[model samples]
Target chain A: MEVKLASSYGFCFGVKRAIDIAQKYENSATMGPLIHNKNEIDRLQNDYKVGLYRDLNEVKPNDTVIIRTHGIPKQDLKDLRAKDAKVINATCPFVTTPQQIVKKMSQEGYSILIFGDSEHPEVKGVKSYGEDLEDVHVILEKSELDNLNFKHDKIATVAQTTRKKEIYLDIVNSLILKNKEVRVFNTICDATFENQDAARDLSKEVDVMIIIGGKNSSNTKQLHTISLENCSDSYLIENETELDSSWFDNKKLCGITAGASTPDWIIQQVVDKIKKY
Target chain B: MEVKLASSYGFCFGVKRAIDIAQKYENSATMGPLIHNKNEIDRLQNDYKVGLYRDLNEVKPNDTVIIRTHGIPKQDLKDLRAKDAKVINATCPFVTTPQQIVKKMSQEGYSILIFGDSEHPEVKGVKSYGEDLEDVHVILEKSELDNLNFKHDKIATVAQTTRKKEIYLDIVNSLILKNKEVRVFNTICDATFENQDAARDLSKEVDVMIIIGGKNSSNTKQLHTISLENCSDSYLIENETELDSSWFDNKKLCGITAGASTPDWIIQQVVDKIKKY
Candidate 1:
């Protein structure tokens, strides 16, 4: 059995930056999680007095606020600032690009639609960028575009940085069919593309595929999702310990791919463990 | 501003499909030009079609022959009864999905990355159904991925139905970085998301965004490329005559967009008319 790895895999710019920033701020938090990782977030809780608040309403004026890579709404920032909260903005640049576009188009009175998960923080941030549109449609399916009755002739379409390109275009194409105007800026991150392409390729040549990353990571999730499409003998795991050897019983060739949030050490560990098998 | 309409815009799904299958059989002219768009493949005409013996040299009894989206690959239906030539297919499931994946994956290597340009007919055709790579990358980056490196794994990436998505992931963030394994599916339907989005939005906004389709009339070229983008003003016109007197003045808000293969209607028409302003 041979082992294969992707050409473009592992921690991306944003994830690398987030991890670094979170580590830097770890000293200040007392009881709150500083990062999204269960292990890392847990470490932060034990180290600092920082507490995660579901909403800012619970936050006092003097408390510190650390924004995640998903990013918070711009308006929320304004309100947070109004209340005199110290903020550590860790918004990924790719995520910020869509917000900028939505903000500009919205200022010009363009109705907005965000192509991504409705609850994603990045999408929420993008929606907040809209000054005029009260709520932006979060399109999920190709059929959803068919159902949309876009009111404005002026509509600006922005994708949450992590959304798939195929789904994004479907909505844009549907809008074109309806004769509604749509300016779409495909803002999905370069990292997500890299991860996906790498995983898809790695999975194909291997008897079994293993996609590693934070389960909550959108890009990681996408990598895992893409891997499943390419190889049935695949598994999505957060770290090496999640390995289930029974699935590999008949498989000799193995391929390994990891998402952006996954640490290099974890991926190496998986590679070593797979080699042992 | 001199509005330069893209040479390949109104590529209907059918045309895109045809082109996809043709490109895959690049070594041989398995069939005629997949799509009828001259401008789309101007390079191919003068660059490659050179051959000595046209017929039998193209394929042998066991050798594979491809049929485009308009057709199928290698040894399809016609030769299936007789072992004349092996079939290689590039049929769009938008032309044949329900039969293949659900059936094939039910027994064999279900994991596959059928590559082709996302918007092209051929790629869209093959990808028309189930268990393909999740979140297909529409492959439109002008640059590369985080770093120009291949992964250490295997990937089952495929191409678009029309054109190929290069396996090259450009190092956009930094050209110099760690090397990784990569499997790339080059799926680029020459007529892609950019034009669709641009045309749709341009048509619905501004004094008027012109539609440049053939007098021969292909609905694909006449596509909406028409969507709303801004509040100032928006309108759509097929040709210069469709332009109303009210649309122009010494000073007016004019935004122009065109479809694929729309020659100006010929670059000349667009230049001459816009020059009048």
Candidate 2:
């Protein structure tokens, strides 16, 4: 089978920046997983001696702490500063923009609505910026809006950087239809759009699709989901080892795509393995 | 034929407030038509002896000028103040919100996208607030967006208060899909939503639909357009005098609705005349 790569795929500006920062600050510990990709984190840990602190309590005084791309909660950042840890913020600018917008708008008495997974680190961090926690709602579906009781008529909404634009638009349209004064901030990363668009285009022409990215990575999952819509024989794998030769038995062409958090090296391995199959 | 009125219709809060202000300030001249309804303007002119000034040049120094509900351009307001005219600002708060948002966002270096008719007074007023006029674009259709050359990546969009929510959503979705940092202000008025929803509901249940308001009124034209979507025999009339007996022929159930600027008295006349037919 012939292996083809998507026109736009793999490490986005934010993920690339975070990786660079992680590499530059060797021996420094990140507040959370620097990026969603476990393989990339492992590489950073082995090569640069970068350590991961899943909990804030793990960090010691005088330690250099690098903030992850998804960012930490406001209170956590304050606590880290109070602990006297030398902080190196590597939070994505796209993620930071929504945080600022939520802080400013919520402070000005506008109810905040975040269109993203509530359990996500990016969403949790953005939600913390709202002045009134009760007024800040994180919802994944448009139907969830019916359960929300907004304290203020004015609402400001922002989407997670790695989310699908169509889903974000659905939530925004629902908010606009119900609320009189809604402010929607489009915070979905540009790389996410390009990657998803490229995957969707390539998946249609190929007999089988292989999406390479961390299983937990939101943007990668989005790309896999989009590829599944076009090609039924689509598979999501972290590396070449996870690839099944049986899936590509009758496949004349194999299209490859990776999430924003995925590294080029991993994609190259996946492409090489598919060519061997 | 049975004449059934829509659940929500007639003069909205803005129009009612404008009318009340016009009545209170007798002998004053409105900078433009106070509302879109010609019959109501005639009532204000005849009953309160209020004058209408089509042009700013018609106003003499010290003339009391009541700003229209749609609002005049920023420069026009300044000129009126410079002429020492006593201006009783009657611009709707809903309309003012978009004007302020456009002025603030545009001044902060964001490109402005106005989803409305370029010739509309409300759009004209809101467009004037943009600090950089070159970056402000007034587009009626999503296709028009392709022709626009934006200097800034950050864009702020606002809809005309009287516009269709669905069309506005289409424009917003299109903007969000293309731009990374789009700020959407849902300036579509609450009354507009209620009126359109009510008209749509009532039109679906009736054999014929009659929309009452000024022919030139944006909201009134929108009501007629929506009514036509569900009811093929939809008719738009200014008052009972415009109604024809032929329209009621074989029509068993007639639905009635009026635009935001339409008066209840005119709606009552249309219903009473429809019953007679």
Candidate 3:
């Protein structure tokens, strides 16, 4: 048996930068959680005085604030600033690309369609930027296509960063067949796409698979969904204790994968447990 | 704005099935076209009829016969009688799953590790049988643990139905700390993982992202990966004339993404067209 490594494993540039920044602003009264990863978030909670105010409503004058990697709603920032709070923007550059699209589409007065979960922080922030325009719709399925009358009027669309890469095209192809004048923006961050690709490539070589990340995190879930379709033996484990003996019984090959939010140390733990097996 | 389509997209289970069996039988002959992506690899080039040859020397009765999803791998009643023919079994279980792992792994005395490329068909195929393994390794970063040099161990590892997912793990924690018996397996199919996730997500929601495919084929570069990702603005056009100018203007939002193996489509078409702005 030959042990091999797929080449696409590492902390994405955005996540790495966010962590470094969070370390610098650890105790800022206005600092939000470091990132979406539970482990990282927990570390920030323990080491830093990150005030989880939820939204701008929770803060007061002179309160120092740290933003998460996802951008905040533009109005919220305005409101916070009016209250004289200090703000540290840690939104990723890849995420900023979508903001440009949202703002441009809104300015053009094209009806907006965002291809992401309505609840996603990135989507919420992008949507906030487009208040100058009247309508913005969040879509998840082909049925959502019916909402458009194919009026041949300009419409602009984009996506959440962590969404699956393939489904995006299926929906777009169908849209073009029905109407012209529909505009689109490929807003998915490059880092997210690379992570998805890397996970797909890595999952193909091992027997029992472990996808390490925060369980509630969307990118991690995306990795889990992609990994499971290819390897049933692949398990998404947020903690090392989740490593079960049954997954390792009498098997020679094993592989591990992680999402964008996954930390290196957690991946290290998964490696040690498999070595013991 | 300029649009770019990703280079990988849209692989079916049937096609991946064919590819997996083809890889294992690469040393010999394939039972049929390894996959359905005609634009990708020509079927005529990769496969041969199972019973056509007998042996490598005389090309007669005992030559190796490979298995394909459309046909049988183990059921060689006609060719088994041939004096010069041997059999190599490979089948994709989206069409079939083998129940033989219990007998095979137990007989071989190998610990099992199964890796699945997140979105490939071959990864799905291998994990179906890896349930009995003690610790399944389905990630790439942790593959170093798979290479334990235990003296008294027999292990068999298997791969997913697709390739490009074999990620080898790094043993940073030092497996020497754990005293455990081990066996390892390497099973990754082919370019399936590389193709599916890389291109599909970005194609949707962009203006005039071109998908290139053979007009006569299905699931080629133009079909699933291309047309599926971006719903509103994706174009599955084989060439440039199909692009509409109205997709862009002096001031507009635009994005581009692509499917896999669409080398026929020119990226300059997008860059030049968007530059009109």
Query: Which candidate has the top score in TM-score?
Result: 2
Worst 10 residues of 2 chain A by lDDT: A159-168
Q: Compute fnat per model.
A: 0.00, 0.57, 0.00
DockQ of predicted model 2: 0.43
Tens-digit lDDT string for candidate 1 (B1-277): 3353433355455555545555555554444344445555554445544112234444556544555444332223444426476555545444454235322432332333343345654444344443433422324343433222322222223334322222322211111122111222222334555666656555444554445555464443444423344423344454666555554554344555555454333435654676566
| Per-model DockQ | 0.02, 0.43, 0.01
Candidate 2 Cα errors over 4 Å, as ranges:
A1-13, A32-46, A52-55, A161-163, A190-277, B1-10, B32-46, B92-94, B190-277
- Give the CAPRI class of candidate 3: incorrect
- Provide the RMSD of all predictions against the true structure, rounded to 1 decimal: 22.0, 5.7, 25.4
Model 2, A1-277: lDDT tens per residue? 7988999999888889888998998899998788877778999999999999979899899999999998989999999999999999999998899999999999889999998889988889999999999999998877888899999877888888455567778888887767766677767767767888999999999999999888887778988899999999999998889988899887799999988777988888888888987
lDDT comparing candidate 3 with the true structure:
0.55
For model 2, state the Cα shift of residue A158 in Å: 2.3
- Residue A29 of model 1, lDDT score: 27
Residue B66's lDDT within candidate 1 is 51
Name the weakest run of 10 consecutive residues (lDDT summed) in model 1 chain A: A27-36
Q: Distance (Å) between predicted and true CA of B148, model 3?
A: 50
Candidate 2 residue lDDT tens string, B107-176: 8889999888999888899899999999999987878888999988888888874556788889888877
